[model samples]
Target: MKHIPVLLDAVKDAIGDMRGLRIADCTFGAGGYSRAFLDAGAHVVAFDRDPHVANDANMFQNKYGNTFRFVPETFSHIGEIDGLFDVIVFDLGISSMQIDVGERGFSFRADAPLDMRMSGKGMTAAELIAKSSVDELATILRDYGDVKKANIIARAAKEKLPQTTFELRDLVFNPNDVAPVFQALRIAVNDEFGEIQRALAAVPNKLACGGRCICVTFHSLEDRIVKNTFRDWTTPPGDARLPETCPAPFKLLKTVTPDDGELENNPRARSAHMRGVIKTC
Candidate 1:
């Protein structure tokens, strides 16, 4: 499956046209934006926890050898990143490549291993669920998946906890309930929320003045965090007593959605919400 970038034109405009600027794509899934930025004349350093992508780096590097670099690390560790990034993009959550292929275990649509590691580390979803307490499973269903019948889901999940992809499908949820359960397990296995939180904390310090950070989230909960952070970072006018007014930590820029054409072609594009923050102070 081709990884057609969501809001490609808007992302280009939001990142702005800058010369010799350093841009970071935290989720360099299929080299969609990284390739585009490099083409637009910027130094691009992309990150992806999945080392598997590195195997294909030769393809991109061969084409754009001098300017492109792929860092095999999560975005949350931006503190360790060497230089400031002008436009730091966080396209959080899974990509279509993972979902389309079954071996990676991201989907319940086809059969594969129970593993759902975005970084290809940590316990597989099957192992985690099989060994976890019913309460633990219940919490995962409720908090991560937001399944209405979390307790029932937990009971079913626990029963088929150590199962492979199809095994768990049969044991935990019927065909209808499968998707939600799969989503919850995948999020927990990837620690998506925790990583985003850690990555967000480093943004204010990592970005240069007037630099922008664009984040596209696939899930409602993830979008909620990004929205709240953008709002809070506005740095409202407070403490009028201070000699000089404190500048806003960041400026909330636009929230963009893919056009209806794009959404109709790629339903995955439907749930996507893109927002940005620009450093103003």
Candidate 2:
């Protein structure tokens, strides 16, 4: 199945011209954006932390030849790529590819191991929950998921954890309703916010003059950091004292929401948002 790229029109508009452009796709889950850019005649280098994505690179190569390249590495280390580009696009957070894999345990609906690592490394979400105290789980759920049921969920999770995904779901998640607690554990496991902030701050320094970076964020915490980073980058040296609402270095290219058609076709795209910026330098 083709992984639907969220905010396609917005991405194309924000991406602008791509001919002969050197572009970096920071989150290259399904190579949707990378393929799109390459089709537009840009030289696209894409990154995905998941090793599994590399296997899919064969599809891009068979179709697009050298136009698309997938580097299996986290965006945090993507900065090591030399020089700037005409455009850098980041489609942040869990891809449909990962969630689709039943073995990865990203979905609460799926019965699998408790793992949620994007890189397939480190402690699985199951392991974390099993080891965490109620307070720890509560903090993770509240801060990561922005969940109001953190206390209740934590208390419930305390009863059983470090088990399979099914066990965790059975204990804390309401089978009738989706679990925000699961989302929280996934976010925590991935260190999503930290990865985002580091990438956001570093990209400006990596950009060439007038290079653009478009970010597609799915969650509020990631969205907030991107919003603030853009503001800070565009803000004047003395503007730090000003309130948060004031616009600063980069202009608000636009906040793109999914159209009804796209949302209807792919429910996962509902929470997706696109923000684009042009480098002031």
Candidate 3:
């Protein structure tokens, strides 16, 4: 299936007139955001850790020439990308390509190796399950997945560490818990929360004065991180228990969600949320 960019129009609106702007497409999943930015005459520096999207990045480079550049790296290291950007957009979580492939182990629909690494490196989901203690697994499920029966699932999963998607799914009897458990495993395997923290911390330094930062998050965990980080950026130091009334560096923008039209066409966008902030200092 073709990967549709979620909240496409809203993202474009947040970036405003992109002509002559330097933008960073932080996730660079399928190059959707980058393509849009390039089409609007912006110079886009796109980053992605997944080697699977290299071809897509190459296509963008060929199509946009000097107007586009791709970096095979994670957004956590976005700070290393010399110079500030007029706008930075991060579409977080697994791309549609990953989930639809079945072999990527992002979805429980097919029996595949329990590999959830976006970069195809690091420990696999199976390894995570095998090594984590019941307490650790419970915490991952509860915090990342918000699964109510986290302890029960963790105990079952620990008895026989699932080597494949189907094996993992079998542990959760309730169909509703399957998705959350899978999500927790994926998040744990990818160290997603840690990466988000790192990326958010580095974002302010990479944004130029009056630059805009836009983030698209699918699940609540990721959305909360984006929301809280933006909140900190918008809050005065005095309110945060600091000595002086140090003003925030960015002004929060309106949050956006998919409309009925977008939702009807793309069911995957149902959980998507988009938030933006503009640098003030």
Q: Which candidate comes out best when scored by TM-score? A: 3
Tens-digit lDDT string for candidate 1 (169-204): 776545666788889989888888989988887787
lDDT of 2 at 261: 91
Per-residue lDDT for 139-249 in model 3, tens only? 999999999889999999999889999999998989999999999989999999999888888887788889999999999989999898887788764565321222346
lDDT of 2 by residue, 7-54 (tens): 877888887777988899898888788878888899888888888887
Candidate order (TM-score) = 3, 1, 2
In candidate 1, how many Å is residue 103 off?
1.4
Off-target runs (Cα >4 Å) in candidate 1 are 237-248
Off by over 4 Å in 2: 62-66, 173-178, 241-248
Question: In candidate 3, how many clashes are counted?
Answer: 0
- RMSDs, each prediction? 3.1, 3.1, 1.9
Residue pairs in collision within model 3: none
Better TM-score candidate (1, 3): 3
